[model samples]
Target: MASTHILSAYDEELKYLNRRISEMGGLAEQMCGDAVRALVNSDTALAQKIISDDVILDHAEREIQDKAIVTIAKRQPMAADLREIIGTLRIAADLERVGDLGKNTAKRVIAVQGTGVPRKLARGLEHLSELALVQLKDVLDVFASRSAEKAEIIRARDEEIDAMYTSLFRELLTYMMEDPRNITSCTHLLFCAKNIERIGDHATNIAETIYYIKTGAQLEGERPKDDTANTVGAPAE
Candidate 1:
């Protein structure tokens, strides 16, 4: 009877960890979407709200870490059980970073205020953010289902986000070169785009963690990356 009771309590602890992770994932998704909307619309009020709400993710991460540490110490989990706790810690950290990226993007809203973003650039940012958010949401679903196959699929899709970011980076550079007047706003947009790109990276990290938890193996080889922004040179004089 005591053994059964201990097992039940351990299961409950794991459930609580998962529940907290889901809440953090949902909040991070909302913050990322709102941050981009605020940037495109120059909505300082909404951006400020996102910045303030970031503390929630930070708090949740710390809570998860504390709980996981205590559970590990108490249960002395091994094998797959230990992997699950470790995976939760890794995912929580990635989600916290996602929230930080969203907060950073929201901070750009104040910088670009009163300087209108071009419709073309706005659309580009929106599309890029849409892809990143989709990746984040999909990986969170993969985490919940514990499907290694779906996690691998999400891992491969990171390259798509990188490609989109590279395209937008070029477009922003062109806008800056064409008109000196566009430099300020375009520069801020560049930072915002980078933040969105990083959000995708965090999503990929979570996908890898899920894959490890399910399979007990780190993904082999370098992660596929196509961000060519660093390779592009200045336009011919």
Candidate 2:
């Protein structure tokens, strides 16, 4: 058991950690949204904005990391609290990758712009992006509250995104075959779908990471069906 002062002092620290993570999550969500918009609106400025936001994500990760280390040294959290501090380091790494993916997607948008691409794939990209955002949003809720149920819901959403990605890919492949004119646009769309898929996966990983923080065990191989949630794919690992 930790001393009263250790836990009490850290109550504020934990809250701040959650707050910082939430802010980082917001950055990730915004990047995804902007990446989609840049593609759909053909706005190079928005794409450039997405590229610039990566610095925020990087800084957030470092800030949270330093705080976590300090908390560990000062508080000496054991059991669940220790897991949480460590797991946050892992989760931040995943979130950083997600931010990078958003940047990559934005770069793809810039490349395809004015290439005479129809941008028709923007519709599918929008759907996939929304799915990812919702999952990540749920993860944020779960992390702040340490609610296993909320984390479970996020896990389920990942599968649905996977299914959508598969379907979107098939549709894109068909389009590319139907018209060489669509090759450029569809390929870019494929990239966007891939990015969304990766985002959904990161969200799911966050959920699992939170679950471990709460329960002290990894929830990887066991995926339960949620009739209430639309999880048709492999429920993001």
In candidate 2, residue 92 scores what lDDT? 83
TM-score of each: 0.97, 0.87
Lowest lDDT 10-mer window, candidate 1?
228-237
Write down the TM-score for model 2.
0.87
Q: What is the lDDT of residue 176 in candidate 1?
A: 95
Alpha carbon lDDT of each predicted model: 0.94, 0.81
Tens digits of per-residue lDDT for model 1 on 86-134? Answer: 9999999999999999999999998888887888989999999999999
Which candidate achieves the best lDDT against the true structure? 1
Error of 1 at 21 (Å): 0.8
RMSD of each: 1.7, 5.2
**Ten consecutive residues with minimal summed lDDT in candidate 2?**
224-233
For candidate 1, the TM-score is 0.97
